[model samples]
Target: MGIVIKQSIKNTIITFIGFGIGAVNTLFMYPYFLGEDYFGLSGYVLSAANILYPIMSFGIQNTLIKFFNENNKTEHELNSYITYMLLIPLVFIIPLTGLFYFNYDTIAAYESQKNPIIYSFVWVIPLIAIFMGYFEIFYAWLRAHMQSVFGSFVKEVFVRLLISVLLFGVYFKYITPLEFIYSLVFVYGMSLLLIVFYANKIKRIVLRFKVPKQSKAIWTYTIFIILSASIANMLLDIDKYMIKHYMDIDNIAFYSVAIFIAMVISVPSRAMHQITYPITAKLMSEQKWEELNELYKKTSITLQVIGGLILVGILVNINQLYLLLPKEYSQGLFVVFTIGLSKYFDLILGNNNAIIFNSKYYKAVLSLGIVLVLLIVLLNMYFIPHFGLNGAAFATLIAITLYSLAKLLFVVLRMKLFPFTYKTIVALGVVLISFFAFYYWDFSFHPMLNIICKSILVSIFYLGLCHVLKISSDINFVMRSIFNKVFKKQ
Candidate 1:
């Protein structure tokens, strides 16, 4: 647990650094520099690329991690195992490009525009897809070696940094919007190259065609994981794809802006999950069921607390937040809340997927992920036409909620594990009370001061309530330690 906390802290700092870098690009730079349609196109292109990423790579990313951890093979052997497993996906996907080539018109038909920008850009899809597949496998290698920071840095930091530069160039009228969108392929390719270079720094990274002693088990797991990974990604990416089909890139931009804000609430969960994956692998390897169960509870409590705070903060100041965006994008306010809530639910399910995936029931995670994929697509199809941006938000919310619930119920039903107690209930109560009190607070005078004062008031009131209930005594200790440190300085 100490290791989990420490590594998670490192990941937290990395995630925030990445988040800050991304916020600059997403919130200020891109929105300010790019027009709505272009901004929307950038968002849609990325959403499409990422949504396609998992399938293009198959389940090979997660498969690499699990297999590498299990076998403890040599450098060449490990590389061969993963490199070969990865080749199978390319084999099928590469040939299918010819098929996709013939159906290019059908693909562009969904793009809101019937032009070369949409049609020509279709070629980049496979490049982006192949880039993503390689990147994920390399990242999994780093992760398997307990090197999350490099992967985090490359994914969260370097890629965004490159994108930021592109946006800045556009801001100065040095590049056109269409060209900027096309630059995504290069940006991603460079990012992939960076990860490969960094992976070499930490360990040997090469593409040797050495044949691996194939195992039937590995192939089976990979197939299951591929199915799971593809669906999981579809659930995450379907909204961006659907919006472009149903509406225009303008709405995609609006909703993407809202999602960028909403994603802040889940950043910590993603960081923690990185640590949890390796730890779960370790625990399951040792058959430490007891510790795994306890981890489930503590991780859930801590993540939900942190996530709830960020969510509340975002929801409370949403109006002020949109004041930072363009006037047209201010309409995405409700989308922020819906997506933030979805992230909070994800926070509460911390390490749940890791636990299930690392355990004997790894296949079940895929089953649930597939179910949610269908749910998300159906929900988005139903909502986007009726409600527009809000509809997309609601669809994501429904999908993630069901996904989380399914994982939670699976853990409890099959494993007899639960992440609840009286303290959990009290903590949730505190969250509710704090949200209602602060969510509707009147904004007046200095906006920053009002935010600070109301947040402090909420903090004090919530802690007071917690002290009365003895909910999360860790919070009490944290407060006392902070005061002690501050007073000691005085």
Candidate 2:
């Protein structure tokens, strides 16, 4: 818990700074400078790259985290493991590169009919995907060593900062929009190099290139991770992919904006999970089920209390947020609500994903993930043409809700532990009451001013209730530290 909290706090600060830069890039720079079509084009290309990342990396990132600490192997054996992590992904990467090269024209012919810009730079997706794959691979390498802050900063902060500078270049006519788009590929490539450099700095990695004793199990885990990661990425990115197919790519820009707003709610979970995952793996290896269960409940309530506050903040002030965006993006109001709810629900599940994925029951969830992927694709296909962007959001909300519930149930039934308790109920009740209390309240001030005032008041009201009710010891610990500092100053 000490390491988890320490790194998570660091990760949280870095992630917030990253998202703040990203918000300016997404909400202000991209739309203002790139315009809707190019913004949508950027969104589509990145989403496409994200979908390709799972395939390119072959799940080496997850495999490394799960297996790295489970054994006390020799240096040679560890080197062997690292070599396999580096090499095995090429099994898919090489062939996919070849396939893209040979069939790019035919693929572009089909997609370019929808957006001809895609045909011109169709190769960028695979390029950026390959780069991001290595980025994650090295990031996992550092994370397994319990050194995640630098990697998180690189991933969440450095990349966005680069993008911000690049967007400014485009705005000042120092770079054309096409140049800006191509620079994105370069940015991802640079990120890979940076992570690789940092990873080597931490532990001068040597590749022994020998087979480890656990080769068979490592391969088995990698295969399942590949399947699971593919399914998960498909569920997350397919909406943007499908949106391009059904409507003009510009709609993807609007949808991306909404999704970004909703995704901020998941940052705390994302930050914490990066550190907690290996710990959960360690716990499972040690067969500490009781300790694991308690960790699970604590994470659930803490994330719920935090995510619930953000969710209410987003939902209550969504209209004011839209007012800040271009009028064309106003259609995404419901998109924010639905996707925000989905993310908050995911946060409430806490470390259930880490627990399940690290346990031997991981393959069961892989099976479930496959089903949900198929279901999400079908739902998106059926709904997007019918309800448009909002329909895609709805499809995601339903698929994710069902997927999370199934995982939670599996953990509960199989392990006899649940993430929810009386505190969970109280935290949710506070969220709803806070929403109703402040949502309809209006101000004569400017929209931005109104948003700020409402957000501060709601956070005060909601967090006050959670502290009073003792919803989470972690939350109280943080509050106590703050109060102690303030009173000591007085």
Candidate 3:
């Protein structure tokens, strides 16, 4: 536990650094410098890349994890499988690139505020997708082998920092916004090379260039996993694409802004999930069902506590948040709750999807993922027409909660495991108390200053409340052990 905390502290610091740059880029500079419409365009371009992501890669990312860890697949066999998997994108990439080259003008013919540079980069999407897929799989390989911090830092921290530099060039007029945005796709390609380098530095990921023998059963599983992953990604990202057709770019910008902030609610859980994955895999390898169950409950509560604080902090002071943004972004306030709730539900279901994916019941995961995607689309269709962005928000909230609850229900019934307990409610109380305390107090300062001050006040109140509630006892036990080691060294 002490070791986990030491490592988690480092990961958390780096993750927050990434989040800081991302928050500034997405929320402030993108909105302030690029303007709402172009910001929306930027959002759309990234969304389109993500939407194409799972398709171009052909589930190679997931296939790598499943294959690499299986002893039956020799190191050479694993490399061959991965090599074939990476090449799988060529099948779609050739056609997609040709399509873009021939019909780009026709494809870019939307009501979008036109930029020829953007269309030029449309070809980069499939190319970038090919490498991004390989990059993610390579990162996952590092993860499976219990080297999560570097992978997480590379992913959550470094990539976004590089993006901030690119955007800074645009803001300073050193590069045209078009060039800056166009370079965005290339950043992904660059990231792939970095990941490959890091993975090799840690332990050689054999890169044999030949296909391996796999039975008919393996192909069936591979196909199912790819289709399942593709469908699931569509559910997450299709909203951004659909908004372009039904609404204006400014509205899309606002919705994207709101979702971006709301996603901050889920970052801690996401970072923690990376570290938890290989540990979960280790348990699965050993057939430690009871330990796995205990870990699940602990992991869920830890995420819920952290996630609950974030959601509470955001909602309680969202008015002040909008005060910092431009007037057009004020409309996003109502949607923040919906988006925040969606991420909250996802956080509470910590590692559930990974658990299912690692288990023999993975087919159920694919089937359920498809069903959830359909539900989200149907809900978005119904809501986007009537409520506009707010409607989209409600639809997202409903879809995410429903999707998460379904996974939780599956885990409970099939595996006889549930992650709720009295400790969970206590943690919720701690966050809620801090939320109201910081929210209601008047801080005589600038909006940015108020933001910083309010955040500090919240932290102090929350930590103080933890002490009063005896949560400090459990935490101190961990801290004391950490310091004991330091003292002995001294």
Among the numbered candidates, top TM-score falls to 2
Model 3: per-residue Cα lDDT over 1-490, one tens digit each:
3434455566766787788888898888888777776787777777777777777766766655555555334677766765666676577767877877698677765423343334555555666666667777778777766677887777777788888887778788888767766787778878888888998888676667776665354456566777777765675677776776667766778988898888888787767776677677667767899988877887777677667767877876787888888888889888888888778878887678767766777787777777778887888888888889898888777777777888789888998878877777787778777776666765777877777777776766765565566543435454567679999999
Residue lDDT tens for model 2, 241-345? 989888998999999999999999999998998898888888988889899989999889989998999899888888887888999999988999999989999
Q: lDDT of all predictions, in order shown? A: 0.77, 0.89, 0.73
Task: State residue 371's C-alpha deviation in candidate 1, in Å.
Answer: 3.5
lDDT of 1 by residue, 1-490 (tens): 7667766767887888998899888878877888787787777677777777777787777766665665555777866775686686776687777787898788666564522345556667777877888888878777777888778888888888888889988988888888888899998999899888888888865666866664666677778877876776676778977887778667877888888889998888888887778777787778888998888888888777767767777777777667667799887889888888888887887788777766678786876787778878888889999998899889998998888888899889998888876667767777887888888765675655666676677667766776676664444555577789999999
Off by over 4 Å in 3: 1-7, 72-78, 81-85, 88-106, 110-121, 209-218, 467-490
Looking at model 3, which ten-residue stretch has the lowest summed lDDT? 110-119
Give TM per candidate. 0.91, 0.98, 0.89
Candidate 1, residue 41: Cα displacement in angstroms equals: 0.5
Q: What is candidate 2's local distance difference test score?
A: 0.89
How far residue 15's Cα lies from its native spot in candidate 3, in Å, is 1.8
293 in model 3: Cα distance from truth in Å? 0.4
lDDT of 3: 0.73
Off by over 4 Å in 1: 73-76, 110-117, 206-214, 446-490
RMSD of each: 2.8, 1.1, 3.2
- Superposition TM-score, candidate 3 onto the true structure: 0.89
